[model samples]
Each structure stands twice: as C-alpha cells, then as structure tokens.
Target: MMFMKSIFALAAFATAVYAQSVTIAAPVEGTSVTAGQNFTVDIARPNTLSPSQEVAVVIGLVSCSEAPFNGNCASFDVSQIFGTILYNGPYTPTLHNGPSPDFIDFYQNFTLTVPSWFTPGSASLNVAHVSLIGAGPFPDLEVKNITLNVVAA
Candidate 1:
C-alpha cells in the first residue's frame, strides 16, 4: 500500500508538471486509432502573465503514417508537413491585460479527420504555436500520435 501511494504521488507530481507546459490532449502516445476518424489536436496556453497582444499564428499538421513513424515522436519535424494553417489570429489568448500569469483562459483546438490517403501504419500529429506579442509570445510545441490501424467494415 505504501509503495502504491508513493507511485501515485509521483504520478500526480509528474502530471502537474507536464500540465504547466503546452501539451496534446488526445490521441495519446503508443495507442491505435482507426483511419478516416476525426481526432482533436488541442493545445493550451499558460495563464496570462501580463497584457499580451497577438501578432500572428503558426500551425502545422503532421501525418507521417508511412514507413518512418516507427521512431520517436519527437524526431518528426513540422516542416515535413505540406499545407496551410486552418486559422489565423492576432489576439491575446484570453485578452488578459492584468497583472498575473493566472488571470486568463485560452486554448487552441483543431479537429482533424485522418485522410483516407494516409498509409495505414504508425502516425503522428504535432502542434506548436508562438503568439507574437509586443514583448514576446509564449513558445509551445505539443504533439500527439497513434498507430493507424484499419477498422473492419
């Protein structure tokens, strides 16, 4: 029981730490998802530190479900994706023009339907954003990946 408690404590601590950074909210690592299914790529920004005005938005769609996704998820590059951003924004995440980092709420959500053309194998979705501001935008890179398996019709 003591060991279990300790493990749980450690896990909680780790989760808390990870949540403080930009992250992927679904299609978790090492799992299998069916092709042609829609999946979400959710990225969250840390609470506001100061008044932040946006300058631009950056987006990338990662779908390397071919023969090379067998390696580490971090090894993939956003440049390999060939496409355009689904949206463009230039506003503060939550428009928190106050004095604390915990003064606002903002997040990015993208709905992705796995293209039928993607090869059935290991696949990944990567996300990152830099919200340019008068000072400097928060830098974040997040990714989620799942094995691409065919579903029985």
Candidate 2:
C-alpha cells in the first residue's frame, strides 16, 4: 500500500510540472486594424518551466469562418490562412507582472503584414504552441484564437 501511495504522488507531481498554456498578449480581442498594414502580435506564457523545456509558437491569421471556430485548433490548417507563419520559434521570456501579482509572464512578438487581399471585416488570429520537453517522442500543443477587426488600408 505504501508503494502504491508513492506512485500516485509521483504521477500527480509529473502532471503539475507539465501543465502549460499560451495566451495572446497584444492586438487584444476586438482590436481594429487596416489591411496591408504591418501589425504585431504578442504571445505570452508563464515563465515557470526549465530552460530545457522550451516552447515554439506558430501564428496564423484567418477569417473567423475558416478557423475551427470551435475554440479549439485540433484540426487547424496552415494553408488556409491569410497571414504568414509570422512567428515560428522559441518564446522570449521577459519579467513582467501578470494577471496575478504572485507571478510574472514573458512574451514574444511577431510582426505580420495583413495580406492586402484581406477583406474589410472581422477575422481570427490563431496560434499553435508546441511545448518541447527535454526528452520526449511527442510534444504537447496548445491552441488559442482571438478576433480582430480589419479595414481597407
């Protein structure tokens, strides 16, 4: 019974250590912009993981109707988006007070030129974050979506 208890404890600890998430820190929800203009998207996450456990983020801006639209990107298509993979690298962690004063958050910014072909209307900015573990066959992924208003430049 004692050995079983130890195993459970270890499992819980592992789960907590692997808990991770990603958030859109800029061009906040409902933000308005113009097509053919350069815009910056800031992606943020908690700076609570070890250096070996690095993260990579891929950003894509698409029409709201084109996204999974279910608040999940389990089936997102990189080819169906308007903006390019504006960012595809590790998140640059910085020290800043976050939602809770108890902790700090870091972010990486990506600049994207809103495609000139984009129509004047609403759109969705989607991101897929892959948490790369020091040693693992499969990386964990977290997806997020934010809405933006676009107008002709």
Q: Whole-model lDDT for model 1 versus the true structure?
A: 0.47
With a 3 Å backbone cut-off (N, CA, C), the pairs that clash in candidate 2 are none
Candidate 2 lDDT score relative to the true structure: 0.69
If scored against the real structure, what TM-score would every candidate get? 0.50, 0.69
Error of 2 at 23 (Å): 0.6
Give the per-residue lDDT digits (tens) of candidate 2, residues 1-153: 999999997885566445556688898998997888999998877766443354677777765544354443334553455354556676665667877888787777788788887766667777888776433434667677777888888
Q: For residues 1-153, could you state the per-residue lDDT of candidate 1 as single tens digits?
A: 999999997896455434444445444665565556766655555653444433434443344544354533455555465323434453234423224664454655666565555555544444444432323444433333333343321
